[model samples]
Target: MGQGLSCATTQEHGLFSAMQSGDLDTVKAMLERDPSLTHQTTAYDRQSALHIAAANGRIEILSMLLERSVNPDVVNRHKQTPLMLAAMHGKIGCLKKLIEAGANILKFDSLNRRTCLHYAAYYGHSDCLQAVLSAAQSSPVAVSWGYARFVNIRDGRGAAPLHLAARQRRPQCVRILLDNGALVCASTGGYGCPGSTPLHLAARGGSLDCTRELLAWGADRLQRDASGRIPYLVALKHKHGACAALLNPSSAEPLVWPSPLKFISELNQEAKALLERALMDANREREKNILKGTAYSLPSPSHSDTGADDNISEASDTELCCICFEHVCTIEVQDCGHQMCAQCTLALCCHNKPNPTIACLNPPVCPFCRSAIVRLVVAKVKDCDDADQDIGEIGSPKMRKARKSRNFSSEGSSSFKGLSVMSPFGKMGGRGSGRMAAENEWVDKP
Candidate 1:
């Protein structure tokens, strides 16, 4: 019996070794010689050949194992499926193969009671995360568990994937989860302290980008955890001055995505991106004001108005927003056709605080035409050569003034980047009143 046990252990070791090293021929030969080898697992962990291949990113080996009818959903000692291992290790190819082999995505591990989705988010493997989500869309999990429910699925500690992503400071993963409908303000039971929202976790983790994404998706900054601490307090506790500035409820309110509006929800991809960017930029402006004269400084903005592509066009052809006299007019008000810079448009919408009792606030009016703002779309800008024709039409003096601000870029943000010295609403114009008071004073009128 001892000799027999020794022989079996050696065989299992050889097979697992071949799979880990991606030795396709050796793995194939071993499997063929002893068909039971396909089902064999390591001694202690009970991790099978499939788990080894998937964890090590042996795509061809993984394919052969799957073809040999090795169960892709086979669990190890920890009850972690091959799919979970693939996701945890960020083996995208292996993960997809396991999914194709009908590996279960909803299988929870014994360690955390967390599914493959939670593993992906916890480890910050966005590609693996996306693959798992895409597979779940068509898999039986969607029907039995519901896609939204799976997205917000909790672990033993009641931490959702969004909670993991935020705690780990995975901005891209957080954004992906939020886009897939992970509850932004969903409270936890024990994860990251009881009743902590993703926002609270993000603050505790000191991730400005993650915090921004949550806030853009309408995360309530005022929501407190069981510890009776808001995200702002969490940021302060962690000494994340930049994140704390943005999370401060006393700071100017950032513009949300306005998802409640049917028209807004129906926007095209490009239009939606413009609006989201506008919202982020507007919030960054607020953060700048709060951090001014402080020890902390924000990192530079991601995208910029001035790029190699901008050099292809003449500055003269760009029509400046007459209201701001700063940025190029990018958003067009439909029917009326009045145009404004994204920042100005966002300012108009966010000028007044929405009543909490009301489900949806009335859409703001166009400052230019006094028309009810309806559908907004990306405006077509004139190409470089059309400069002389429309230069006067857009007001040459305003265009010239815009050039000055364009010459001064704020940490490589945009041609018209002036958040340090300007309000998001350009017309606010150093009104001496605080940002909140300045926003309150602005009246949309004909």
Candidate 2:
């Protein structure tokens, strides 16, 4: 029995050697001499002559083996079928011959669970993927095979084909998967690293063209990964300023005020302060430019001011206080040509205080021309009493007494009775005593 087994083993080795060397005539002669040899296992790697023929792309030998009904589904110790070996080596003719002989197209390797399609995409072999896809289409298990091999197939680490393509910067593979309806937003199975949406991956990779393409395809810019970071912020964090700017232009402005004392509230303080400063400076510069004509530095006219020839010429030429949004009363112009009301201008300065630098206030621009305030306005409120009086007197005793008496019940006293007074002079203390005191004070003045 030992000698008989030795003879059988020797014959199998000879057939295996013939298959490996693509000696189809020798393989056919050996198989024909012993019909039982078709079912015989080979020595060495245990791969039969059919397995060797398919792997080496010997289409004629593979056909001859299949015609004899050699087990096409048989796998070696690695659980790789003959068809898998053919596909991996890009043996298109051998693969077609095996498929025609009814080889399983969707069989996965036992070690890696990788179907033939995975190998094709991994190697970037478009033709291989096409062949596998075509064979899979007509199979009885087509739907199951499609799902297992195409739709959600993931590696041991849960990385879909798209993830691999992205990490490798394989744009062509990415496009193929996208065309095949692969989910670009699928997350990998890991912790602390929320898997990226395809857009996030593109941005993180600094593939601007890919990023734009993903955006054009409706990728959400505001989508956050597992880390609470939007894609734009991620770009900024990575110092991709150009990408961040493209994603959100408003982020470029001084939207946040560093100090708390500048505004009434915390929320939107930066935005409000920025807008307020911009509007004030814009108005101030517009007035300064109008006053100085060609000599002043002016921002190019904005679209809103396009038809302003009538208004710019007809409008008052006096400089306006950029801070208060009022005409520059008691005008004080900074070296930067920005004008402000003298009082408003000085309020921005740190006179009679430590750290008297005008930089402390961080004004947006010049108070007069709305350019920029290089040196602070040191002027104070002039003609304070005249300005106050124009609005209304604050401390006149007659006015005070009249204001006080006007609130009193008219029925309470004889002093309040019959106090009918003219409208203009009525509230000034009813004409007699108030009028006489006023005249006396006027006579005493100057």
- Measured by lDDT, the strongest candidate is 1
lDDT of 2 at 58: 84
Per-residue lDDT of 272-388 in model 1, one digit per residue for the tens? 787778777666766777788888776657876555235433544445565555666667776665666676666665432323455565666555445567788875433245443
10 residues in a row with least lDDT, candidate 2: 431-440
Give a tens-digit lDDT track for model 2, residues 133-243. Answer: 667667855676464346447655566666555554455556556545566456665412465666566556565445433433334556677787776776777675444
With candidate 2 superimposed using the best TM-score fit, by how many Å does residue 143's alpha carbon deviate from the native? Answer: 4.1
lDDT (CA) per prediction: 0.74, 0.49
TM-scores, all models, native as reference: 0.78, 0.43
Model 2, residue 218: C-alpha shift (Å): 6.1
lDDT of 2 at 41: 63
**Which pairs of residues have clashing backbones in candidate 1?**
none
